[model samples]
Target chain A: MLHMLEKTIADNPLITAFAFVGVVIWVSNQIGRHLTGGRVAGSAIAVLGGLALAYWGGAVTGKAKGLADIATFSGLALMGGAMMRDFTIVATASEVHVDEAKKAGWLGVIALLLGTVLPFIIGVLVAWSFGYTDPIALTTIGAGAVTYIVGPVTGAAIGASSDVMALSIATGVVKAIMVMVFTPVFARFMGLSTPQSAMVFGGLAGTVSGVSAGLAATDRKLVPYGALVATFHTGLGCLLGPSVLYLAVKAITW
Target chain B: MVIFGTALLAACYLAGIWVGEAIAVLIGVKANVGGVGIAMIFLIAAQHFLKTKGLFPADTEKGVTFWAMMYIPVVVAMAATQNVVVAIKGGPIALLSAVGSFLLCFGVVALINRSMQRHASPEEADASAALASAPDALKSR
Candidate 1:
C-alpha cells in the first residue's frame, strides 16, 4: 500500500504540488484568522512563509532554486516556472471589465511616469551610496527598483554583467513582495478605495503582479484599475532606464 | 465543468509573448518585455470582443474564476521559487535599495492621496470609503 502510494505521488507530481500548496494555504489562512485576527492577510502570510521556506531550502541545499530544488517538491519548479507565472497573470484578468478600467485618464499617465522615475532615482542613489559608480550597474539596478522585468531588460541593453543583472532582479523581486504585503496594511491611510486613487497608486507602485495582488486584497474592483496603469511601468521604465536615467546618473557620477 | 477560456488565455499569452519578444528585439534586449502585461491586454480585448459578438458564455466566468481564485497560491509558488538566502548574500545594497525605494515611494503615494482628499473627490468622503468600514471592498473575490 505504501509503495503504491509512493509511486502514485511520484508519477503525479503536479497533483502532489497542488496538495502541498493547498495544505500550506489552509494552515496559513487559519493562522491569519485565529492568530493574526485577520489583520495580516492569509495570502500575504503564505507568500512570506513560502519565502522563508525557500530561504531555508537554499540554506540547507546550497541551491538557488529554493524549495523547487528539493526532489519531492520538484514539481514546484514547473508550477512556479515562467509559463505558469505568465499564465496566472493572464488568467486573473478574467474578472476585469474594460469599461470600468477606462476611468483612469491622463492622470494615470502622470502617475505612471512619477511611479517609474521616483523609484529609479531612489535605486540609483542607493547604488551610488553603496559605491557602485558604474553606469551600467547603476542603471540596471535602478531599473530593477522599477520592476524585475525592467531590471534585466535594462541590464541587457546597457551591457551590465550577469552578476549585476541578477542583483537587479533580486532587488525588483523584493520590492514586488514588499508592495504586495504593505498595500493592504496601508490601504486605509492612502485613500486606496476609489478607481482614481487606485489608478494613481498603481502608477506609483509600478508592478503588475505586486499591484494586482495588493489591489485585489484591498478591493477586487480596484485590481483592474491599478493593474491597468501599473502595466505601463515596465515599458516606461525600460525606455527611461537605459537612456535618460542612465545619463542623469552618469552625469553626476562619471 | 466546461473549463472554458483556457484556450483563449493560451492564445492571448502566446500572442503577448511574441509581441513582447518583438519589442525586446527592436530595443536590443534579450528578454520578453511586458509579455505578461501584453497578454493581459490581449485577454481583455479578446473577452470584450467575444462579449460583443454574444459568443461569451456566462459559464466561462466560472472557468476564469477557478483560475483567478488560485491567484494567491500562484503567488506563493512564485515566492517559493526565489532563493532568498542567496539574494541576501549577494549584498546589502539590493535589500537596502528595495526598502529605501519602497519607503520613499509609499510616502509619495500617501502624499498624493492626502492631496486628493484635501480636494475631496465626492465619493471618497462617503463614510464607507475607509477600507475597514467598506464591507464590500473588504470581501475580496
Candidate 2:
C-alpha cells in the first residue's frame, strides 16, 4: 500500500504538487496569523520556507530544482515553472482599475521614478562596495534591488551569469520581505493615511506582494491603492534596469 | 464564461512571451526580458478592452479570480525555482544590496512624507488627520 501511494504520487506530479503547495501555504498562513500576529506577511514566511526546503532538497539530492528534485515532488518543476509564475502575475494585474489608478496623479509618478532609481543606485553602490565591479553584475544586482521579477528579468537580458541572476532574485526577495515587515511599522510615521499617500508609498516601495501585504495589514482599504502603483514598478523597473541603468553603470564603472 | 477568462490569461501570457522574446532578440539578448511584466500589461489591457466591450461579465471575472486564488501557491513555487543557498553563499553582495537599498528607500519615504507635510495646506492636513482616524474611507471603489 505504501509503495502504491508513492507510485500514485510520483505518477501524478502536478496533482501532488498542488496538494503539497496548498498545505505549505495553509500552514504558512496559520503561522503568519498566529506566530507573528500578522506583522510578517504569510507570503513572506512561505517564501522563506520555500527557500529552506529548496536548500534542504539541494542537500539531500545534490541536484537543483530544490524539492522537486525528489521524485514525489517532481511535479513542482512544472508547478513552479515560468508559465505558472507569469500567469499569476498577469492575474494580479487584472485587479487594477484604470480610474482608480488615475488617482495617484503626479506625486505617484515622481515616487515611482524615485523609487525605481533610488533602489537601483543604492543597490549598485552596495554591489560596488562588495567588489562586484563588472558592469553587468552591478546593474543586475542593482536591478534586483528594484524588485525580484525585475532583477531576474534585467539580469537575463544583460547576459548576467547564473550566479549573478540568482543573487539578483535573492536580493529582490529580500527587498520584498523588507517591505512586508516594515510598511506597517512605519505606516503612520510615513503618513500613509490617504489613498494618494498609499499610492506614493506603493511607488516608493515597489513590490506588489510587499506593498499589498503591508497595506493589507496596515489597512485593508489601502491594499488596492498601494498595490496599484506598486504594480507598475515591475514594468518600469524591467524597462529601465537593463537598458538605461546598464549603460549608466558601464559608463561610470568603465 | 469563466473559462474564457482563463483562456484570456493564457492568451495574454503567450502574447507577452512573444513580445518579450521579440524585444530580447531586438536588444541582442538571448532570453525573455519582460515576459512576466509584459504579460501583466497585456492582461490588464485585454481585460479593460473586454470590459469596455461589455464582454467581461462578473462570471468571467470569476475565472480570473480562480487563478488569483492560486497566487500564494504559485509564488511559493516560483520562489522555489531559484536556488537561494547558492546565491547567498556567493557572498554578502546579495544581502547587502537588498538591505542598503531598502534602508535608503524607507528613509526617502519618510523624507517625502515630511516634505509633503510642510507643503500641505491646512485643509489637506485636516484631510490627512481625518483619514488617519477612518481608513475605511480610503476605499474609493
Candidate 3:
C-alpha cells in the first residue's frame, strides 16, 4: 500500500503541484495575518502570491506558448476581481446576526456540499453533452473553480478570514493535482499532441476562478451574484485559453 | 477604502457622543456615564455598519459578542492553515516561523498601545487607570 501510494504520487504531477500551492498559500496566510491583523489583508496577500507563483511556474516550465496566454490570464484575474467586488457588496448588505437568523445547521452543511460538488457534476454533464469520453479536464477545471471560488467567498461572507486562506491553499493544491492528473487525460480526450500544456491552461483557469471568488467575498453582497459572474467568466476563459495556446504555438512555428 | 471606512466610523461615533451630550443638556437629562453609554451605542452601531450586519448573526447585540463571532472563523482558519503548513515543513522550521510571526505582530501592537498610553493626558490616564482597576475589583468580588 505504501509503495502504491508513493508511485501514485510520483506519477501524478498534479498532486505535487497541489501540495506545493497549498503549502505556499498556508504560509502566506500566516504571514499576512501576523502583519495585517485581518483576514482581508491575508487573502489579498495570498492572491498576489498565487500570481507570482504562476508566473514563476510558467517561466521555469519553459512551456509558455506565448505572452498572450499570460495576458489572458491577467485579464481574467481582473474581471474575476471586479465580479467579486460586486458580490461582496451584496453579501454585506444582506448580513444578519446569527441569533436571529434561521439556523440551517445540517441543511446549511448540505447546501455547502452541494454547492461545492455540483460544479464537477455539471462539468461532467457538459463534457458528455459535447461527446467527450474522458471527463478529466472538465472535472479538474470544475473542481478547481468550485473549491477556490466558493470556499473563499463563503468564508468571507461568514467572516471566516482564516478559512479563506486555508481554503485558498486547499483549492490551490487540488488545482495543482488536477493539472498533473488530467493533462494527459485531456490531451487524449481532445486528440491533442501536447496534453501537459492543456493541463497547465486548465490550472490557470482554476486559479483565476479562485482569485475572483476571494475578491467577491471581501464584502457580503457579492456572494450569490459573484458566483454567477465567475461561472461566465471562467467559462469564457477556459474556451479562449486553449485558442491562445494554439495561436502561440503557430506564431512560434512561423 | 477599508482604512478610510474604519476612520470614518470612528469619527462618526465620536460625533455621535458630542451630539448626544448636547441633546442631554437641552433636555435636562442626567449626566455622568450616560453620555459615555450613548457614545458606546453609537460606536457599536457604527462598527456594525462598517463591518456589515451580514457578517454577524441578525440578533447579535452590537458589541464584543458581534466581534467575537465575526473573528472566530478567521482565527480558526488561520490557525488550521498555519498548523498544516508547519506540519508539512517539519518541526523546527515551522515552530520557529509560527512563534516568530506571533511575537513580531504582538510586539508591534504592544508598542502602539504603549505609545498611545504615554501620550494620554494625566486626567485621561487617571480615568483609564481607574477603569482598568475597576475591572479587577469586579473580578475579585
Candidate 4:
C-alpha cells in the first residue's frame, strides 16, 4: 500500500506539489489565526514559511530551484511558473469594476507616479551608498524597489548580472514584508479607512502582494481598491525601468 | 458553463499575451510587454462587456474568484522560495539598500498622507468611515 502510494505521488508530480502547498497554506492559516489572531495575514506567514522551506531544500539538494529541485516536487516549478502567475493576476479582473475604481481619480494617478519614482530613487541611492556604482546594478536594484516582478524584468532588460538581479528581488521582498507587517499598525495614522486613501496607498506602495496583504490586514474591503491601483505600478515600472531609468542612471554615473 | 467560462478566460489571456508581445516588439525589447498587466486589462474589459450584455453569470465570477484567491497564496509561496542564496552572497549592500529604501518610502508616503489630511474635512472622514463600514459583499460587487 505504501509503495503504491509512493509510486503514485512520484508519477504525478503536479498533484503531489498541490498537496504539499495545500498543507503549508493550511498550517500557515492556523498559525495566523491562533498565534497572531489574524493580525498578520496567513499569506504573509505562508510565504515566509515557504522561503524557509526553500532554503532548506536548496541546502539539502545543492540546487537553486528549492523544493522543485526534488524529483517529486518538480511539478512545483510548473505550478508556480509565469503562466499560473499571469492567470491569477488576470483573474483579479473579475472582481474589479471600472466605474467604481475611477472614484479615486487624479490623486490616485499622482500617487502611482510618486510610488514608482520615489522607490526607484531611494533604491538607487541606497545601492550607491552600498558601493554598487554600476549603472546596470543601480538601476536593477532601484527597479527592484518598485516591485519584485519589476526587479527581475528590469534586470533582464538591462543586462544586469544574475546576482544583482537576485539582490533586486530580495530588496523588493523585504519591502513587501515590511508593507504587510506594518500597514495595519499604521493604518489609522495614515487615514487608511476610505477607498480613496486605500487606492492612493496602493499606488504609492507598488508591491501587489505587500499592499494586498497589508490592506487585507487593515481592512479587507480596501484590498481590492488598493490592489487595483497597485497593479498598474508593475506595468509602469517595467515600461520605464530598462529604457528611461537605465539611461538616466548611466548619464548620472558615467 | 464552467468550461465556457474557463475558455473565455483562456481566450482573453491568449489575446493579452499577443498584445503584450506586439508592444514589446514595437518598443524594440526582447521580452513580453507586461503580459499579466495586459491580461488583466483584457479580463476587466471583457467582464464589463459580459455584464452589460447580461451574459455574465455569478458562478463564472465565482470560479474566477476562486482562482484569484488561490493565486494570493501562490504569490506568498513564490516569495518564500525565491533565490535568497544569491541575494545574500551579493552582500550587505542589498540588505542595507532594502532597509534604507523602505524607511524612506514610509516617511515620504506618511508625510504626503498627513498633508492631505490637514485639508480633509470631518465630513469626508465620516463618509469614508461609512464606506468602510458598508457590507463587504455589496462593496466587492
Candidate 5:
C-alpha cells in the first residue's frame, strides 16, 4: 500500500497536491467548526490545510534529497510564523480616531499604491540578481496576488472572522479565473516554459493564501496554526518538486 | 508569492469603490459625511444582514461564506497556473507589501477614531453622561 501510494504520488504530483490540499481544507474546516462553534474554524482549517500539505509533501519529496529541502521547508515555516506575528500586532491595535477617517482613507490609498509598486521593484531587482530574464511579468503576477488576496484576508480576519468563508470562496474562484486567464499572457510576456510559468503562478497562489490567512487571524493563538498551513502547502509543493523539476527539464531540453 | 497579486486585487477593490463613489456623486446623493458615511452604510448593512440571519451571534457561517467566495477566484488562478517555483521565491515580498499597505490603512483609521473621540462636543458628552447615568439611576430606583 505504501509503495502504491508512493508510486501514485510520483506519477501525479498535481493531483496529489490538489487532493492533499482539499482534504486538509475539509478536515480543518470540520475541526475549526467543532472547536469555535463559528465559521472562524474555516480560517483555522485553511491554516491547518496549508501546514499538513507542507509537512506531508516535504516528507515524501525529501526522502532522497536529504535535509536541504527539509531545512528550506523549516525556514519557510518560520517565515510563515513571522508573517503571522506582524499581522496579529496590526490587527490587535485599536481603530483610528473617527476624525482621522479621511486621513486614514487617504493613507489607505497611498498604502495601496506603495503596496503595488514596491513589490514589483523588489522582485525585479531580485530576478535581475539571479539573471532571470523578463522579471516584470513575474513581479506583476506576484504583486497582483498579494493586492487581491492578502489585503482582503487580513482586513476580513482582523475586522471580522465571519468574512472568512466569503473571502475564501471568493479568493479561490478569482484565483482560479486569474490563473486560467493570466498564465498564458504571463508565459508569453516572460517567455517562460509552461512548467516554469505554472510553478511561478502556483507559488504565488500559495504565498498569497498563506499570508492572507496570517493577516486575517485575530487571536495571537492562531498564528501557529496559520504558519502550519503555509508550511504544509510549501511542503506539498516541495514533495512534488521532483516531478515538476523533471517536467521543467524535459521542456527545456526539448 | 501570490502576495504580488494583492496589489492588483487592491486596485480592483479601489476601482470598485471609486465607481461606487462616482455614481453616488453623479447622482447628487447627500449624506451627513462623505466617505465615512458611505463606508458606515456598508458596514451597517453587513452587520444588519448578519444579525438578521442570526449569523452574528453564535453563527459565523455567513461570514465564512463571504471569505470562501473571495478565495474562489484565487484558488482557480492557482490551479490554472502550474508554476510553483516563482511563487515560492516571490511570496514573501508580496506578503510584506500587502501587510504594509493594510497597516497604513488600519493605523490611519485608528487615528481618525481617536480624533473623533477627542473632539466630541460638550452636548454630545453631556448626552452620553446622561445615558450612562440613566442606567445607574434605574438600578438605584
Candidate 6:
C-alpha cells in the first residue's frame, strides 16, 4: 500500500505538490494556534515551515530549487513560478478599491517614497560596510533591502554576481521576518490603529507578507489597507532600484 | 457570472503583461517592467470602470474576492521556499547586511513615526489616542 502511494505521488507531481502544501499549511496553522496563540500569523508559521522543508530537501537531495529537486516534488518549481506569483499579485490587486485607496491620501504617498528610498540608502550603506564596493553589487544589495523582489530584479538588470544577488535576497528576507515579528508589538507605539496609519505602515514596511501578517495580528480589518500601499512599494522599488538608485550608487562608488 | 469576472481578470493580466513588456522595450532594458504591477493597475481600473457603469454584478465581486483571498496562501508558500540555502552559503556578509539593514530601517521608521505624531494636530492626536485605546474599533470593517 505504501509502495503504491509513493508510485502514485511520483507519477502525479501536481497532485502531490498540492497535497504537500495542504499538509504544511495544516501543520503551520496548528503551530500558530497552539504555540503562539495566534499572535503569529499562520502564513508566517507556514512560511517558516516551508523554509525548513526547503533546507531539509536541499540537504537530502543536494540540489538547487530545494524541494523541487526531489523527483516527486518537481511540480513545486512550476507551482511557485513567476506565473503563479504574478497571478496571485494580480488577484490581490483586484481587491483594492481606488476610492478607498485614495483615503490614504498624500501622507501615504510620502511614506511610500520614503520607505523605498530610505531602505535603499540603508541597504547600500550596509553593503558598503560589508565591503561590497562595486556599484552593481551595492545597488543590487541595496535594492534587496527594499524588497527581495527588487534585489533579484536589480541584480539581473545590472549583472551583479549570483553570490551578491543571493545576499541581497537574504537581506530582504531578514527584513521581512523582522517586520512580521515586530509589527504587532509596535503597532500601538506606531499609532497604527487607523486606516490611514495602516496605509503608512504598509508603505514603510514594504513587504506584503510581513505587513499583512503583522496587521493580521494587530487588527484583521487593517490588513487590506496596509497591504494596498505595501503592494505599491514593490513596484516603486523595482522602478527605482535599477535606475535612479543604481545611478546614484555608481556616481558615488565610481 | 463568476466566469465573466475570471475572464476580466485574465484580460487585465494579459494587458498588464503587454504594457509591462512594451515599457521594458521602450526603456531598452532586458528585465521585465513589472508585469504584475501593470496588471494590478489595469485590474483596479477595470473594476472601477465596471462598478461605475453598474455593469458589475455582486456575484462577480464575490468571485473576485474569493480568488484574491486564495492568493495570500500562495504567497505564504512562496515565502517559505525562497533561496535560503544559497543565501546562507554566501557568507557572513549576507547575514550581517541583512541584520544591519533591518535595524536601520526599524529605527528610521520609529523615528519618523514619532516625528509625525509630534507634528499631528491636537484634534488628530486626540482622535488617534481614542482609536488606540479602543483597538476593537480598528478591527471592525
Report lDDT (CA) for all predictions.
0.73, 0.77, 0.33, 0.73, 0.32, 0.71
User: TM-scores of the models, in the given order?
Assistant: 0.74, 0.87, 0.22, 0.82, 0.30, 0.81
RMSD in Å for model 3: 25.3
| TM value for model 2 | 0.87
Docking verdict class for candidate 3: incorrect
A99-181, model 3: which lDDT tens digit per residue?
21122223223323333333334433433343434222333322323434333332322222231233233443344233223
For DockQ, the strongest prediction is: 2
Distance (Å) between predicted and true CA of A71, model 5? 28
RMSD of candidate 1 to the truth, in angstroms, is 5.5
Highest lDDT model number: 2
Q: What is candidate 6's CAPRI-style docking category based on DockQ?
A: acceptable
Which residue pairs in candidate 1 have backbone atoms (N, alpha carbon, C) closer than 3 angstroms, thus clashing?
none
Compared with the true structure, what per-residue lDDT tens digits does model 4 show for residues A148-172? 7677667765567755765787777
TM-score of chain A of 5: 0.28
- Pick the winner on TM-score between candidates 4 and 5: 4
Worst 10-residue stretch by lDDT in candidate 1 chain A?
A96-105
Query: Would you list the clashing residue pairs of candidate 2?
Result: none
Q: Candidate 3 lDDT, tens digit per residue, B18-137?
A: 664575466453321122223334544555664564544324223333332222222222222221331232223212322232223223323433444457577754543432221111
Q: Is the docking of candidate 2 incorrect, acceptable, medium or high quality?
A: acceptable
- For residues A1-254, write the lDDT of model 2, one tens digit per residue: 99999889978999998998888888888998899887667777787777777778767887756777888888877887756765776677776666555556678789999999998998888888877899998988899899887776677667777557667877888888888888888887788767667877889999877888888888887787677788778777876776667878888997
TM-score of model 3 (first chain only):
0.28
Instruction: Please compute DockQ, using alpha carbons, for every candidate against the native two-chain complex.
Output: 0.39, 0.48, 0.01, 0.43, 0.04, 0.37
lDDT of 6 by residue, A172-244 (tens): 7677777878888887777776666777788888877778878888897778777777877876676577666
